[model samples]
Target: MLKNKLATLLIYLVAVLITVTFICILADIIIHGFSQISWGYLTESPSDAGRAGGIAPIIVSTALIVFLAIIIAAPLGLATAILLTEFAQQKTIFAGFVERCLDVLASVPSIVFGLFGNAFFSLYLGLGFSILSGGLTLACMVLPILIRTAVEGLRATPDDYRFSAAALGITRTTALVHLLLPTAMPAIVAGLILGIGRAMAETAALIFTSGYVDRMPDSVFDSGRSLSIHIYDLSMNVAGGDSKAHAAALVLIVMLLIINAISMGLAKHWQKNRIISNEIII
Candidate 1:
């Protein structure tokens, strides 16, 4: 009993410490950014000093990139996951090899992706530093993440469901579409949310491929900077350094919070529907 109590105490202490650290960081961000934050700053375009500039362009660009990245990553990732789970036999060497390749892709450094995007898309493909180029580059960066998460989600479904569907003489494709994908929807959505978060926060890849244009994007082929890159530029190039940087940092944090809240709300709603579906199935 004494040992158990000690273990519990240690666990609680660790949890409290982690919570405290997170709260402290959030507080620091809020304190630094609160004074500079206003509706005008959030809505206005870039100013000469970036001090009075709004983050509207950055917000819009970030959203567009994330949307495009999701559009590219979702179908491919979901298809790959479905193929691996439903079609690929466990003993197939090719399946194992493909899975390993995805792991390697996930582990590759972001800087390498940045360089590749700069070379191929920006220079070789002649897309220039445009939203499309940057979006495609970010798509590549998030592809591995989405695919892995989707695979995990697919695998999380019970084998019993697939076996039962097969026993009912359902075609493999039908079983996947009618049973497996629906069962895994929550997890797949989770992966998509994570992918969007990563794409929004990415800086290096966008820096090289997206360009540092302060103007609003009129087309997918137009050059633009995302929120992450905008913050970097403001901090490094803007006069008076720390003040504007702190303000930008604060805005970025708030935007992240807003995104997370929306994602979590959607996830919860999906999870509720999933529960209802599962109840119906049972």
Candidate 2:
């Protein structure tokens, strides 16, 4: 009992410390940077090498990249996860090998993905530095994370659920689509949120694949800038760019928070609906 009490106290302390730190960071960024945000600041294009203009173009580019990446990755990731959890035996050598590969892929440094993006997507593929290339790179980065989370989520579903479905004479594919996917909705949503967050803040990989052009792209093949790259360029290279850097940081943080809030809300709603449906089924 004494040891359990100590462990509980330690967990609480750690949680509080983390909560305080995150709050402090968000507060500091908003307090210092909110003043920089205005109608003109948000609507105007960046000028004078990104030191004097607004971030309208950057916002558009970021949106396009994120949209493209999600569109490319979500279906593929979900399908792969379904295959892993539904078809492959958990104890099998192939399944274990794939999981190990996923773990290693997830642990790879972002900078390495950047270089690979540069070498393959940007150069070999002849896409050059463009939104398409960047989005593809981000899709690659997000794939492992989403697959791992989704596989775990699917695995976490009670086997009784499958057993009951099997007994009902439902096909395996039908059961997967109707029951298992809904049951794993919350975890799948969480993985998507994490993947989006990672894609949003990534600078290095995008910088190599997506050219840092602070303008609206005519097409996916056209070069464009992202918010993360904008922040990096402003803070590291441009003179008198501190305010803009802070403002961009604030915007990025706010975007992530909003995405997380919406995704979590959807997850809760999905779980509630699932519970109601199951209760009705019984």
Candidate 3:
């Protein structure tokens, strides 16, 4: 009892420490960056290599990269998850090998992924330093996290769900589409939020794959810059760019929060619908 109480206290202490640190960082950004944020700042294009003017073009570039990344990753990740959890024999050697591969991929450094993207997508595939290359690189980086999370979510579903569907003479595909996916929506959304957050925060990968062009991209094939890359350039290369850097960081953080919130909301809504449907069936 005493040891358990001590562990609980320790956990609470760690939680409080993390909360305080995050709050402090946010406060610092708002303090230094709030003055730099304005309608014109968000709408105008940056000048003098991000030391002057605003970040409209950079924002557009970031949005395109992130959008393309998600559009590419989500369906592929979900399909992989379904295949692993629904079709694969869990105790087989092939399943074990696949899991190991995913684990290793998840642990790889982002910079290595950047180099691979530059070598393969940018050079070999002839995508050049463009949004498409960056998006594909981020999709590769995000896949392991999303697949692992979704597989676990599917695995956590009660076997009764499958048995009931089978007993009702429902096909596997129909059951997967209507039952398991909705039940696992929350966990899938959690993975998506994590993947998006990582993609948004990445600077090195974007710099290598997307190139540091702050001009608004006219197409996915056009070279672009991500918000994280902009923040890095401003802080590292531009003199007296602290305010803009802080402002950009704040925007990035806000974008991440918004995505997380929207994902969570959708997950909850889907889960609620699933529950209501189950009740009606009963």
Candidate 4:
């Protein structure tokens, strides 16, 4: 009992520390950033080498980059996760090999992905430094994370679910499509959300694959700059652009937080409905 209480106290203390840190960081950014966020700043395109005007193009480009990345990554990640959890033998050499591959993949530095994107997608495939190239690069980067989280989610489903399906004479394929997939939706979505966060904030990978164009993208072939890259350009390269960078950082943080909240809410809502529907059907 004494050990249990001590462990509980330690967990609470760690939680408090993390909460306080986040609050402090948010307060600092918002204080410096809120004043810079005007309607014109958000709606007008930047001018005078990023020293004047707004970030309208930047916002649009960032949205497209994130959208493409998600579309490219989610399907591949889900397929891999399903294959590993539902098909592969748990104790087999093949399973062990794949797990090791994921471990190494997750540990690879992001900058290396940028180089690979530049060499392969940008040059070899002739996609050049375009939104499509960037999206594909980010897809590769997000795969490892999604695979890890999705595997956990799939494994979390109770064995009884499979037993019940078997008892009902449901085909394995049908059960997977109708029951297991829906039941695992929340976990899969949670992984996708994390992937979104990583892809959205990624700079190095986009640096090589997504060009530093300040204008809004007209097509998938067009090059674009993301918010994170915009922040880097203003803060590091441009003179007298700190205020705008701060404003962009503030927007990025708020956007991420909002996306996270909405994704989580949707996942939970769908998961609940799926559970209800499955219960009725069974």
TM-score against truth, every candidate:
0.88, 0.88, 0.88, 0.87
Compare candidates 2 and 4 on TM-score and give the better one: 2
Pairwise TM-score winner, candidates 3 and 4: 3
How far residue 90's Cα lies from its native spot in candidate 1, in Å, is: 2.4
- The TM-score of candidate 2 is 0.88
Which one wins on lDDT? 2
Clashes of each: 0, 0, 0, 0
Which segments of candidate 4 are over 4 A away from where they belong? 1-22, 263-282
Lowest summed lDDT window (length 10), candidate 1: 239-248
Tens digits of per-residue lDDT for model 1 on 1-282? 999999999999999999999999888877877877788877899777566677788778888878888898889888888778777856478788878988888877888888988999999999999888888888988888888878888888899988899899999889888888887887788788888889988898888888888788998888888888877887788766556667778877776778788778977898789789889989
What does the lDDT read for residue 133 in candidate 4?
A: 94
| lDDT winner, 1 or 4 | 4
For model 4 the local lDDT of residue 141 reads 90
Q: Per-residue CA lDDT of candidate 3, range 161-227, in tens?
A: 9999999999999999998997887888888888888888888887789999988899999999999
**Worst ten in a row by lDDT for model 4:** 89-98
Error of model 1, residue 148, in angstroms: 1.7
lDDT of 3 at 120: 94
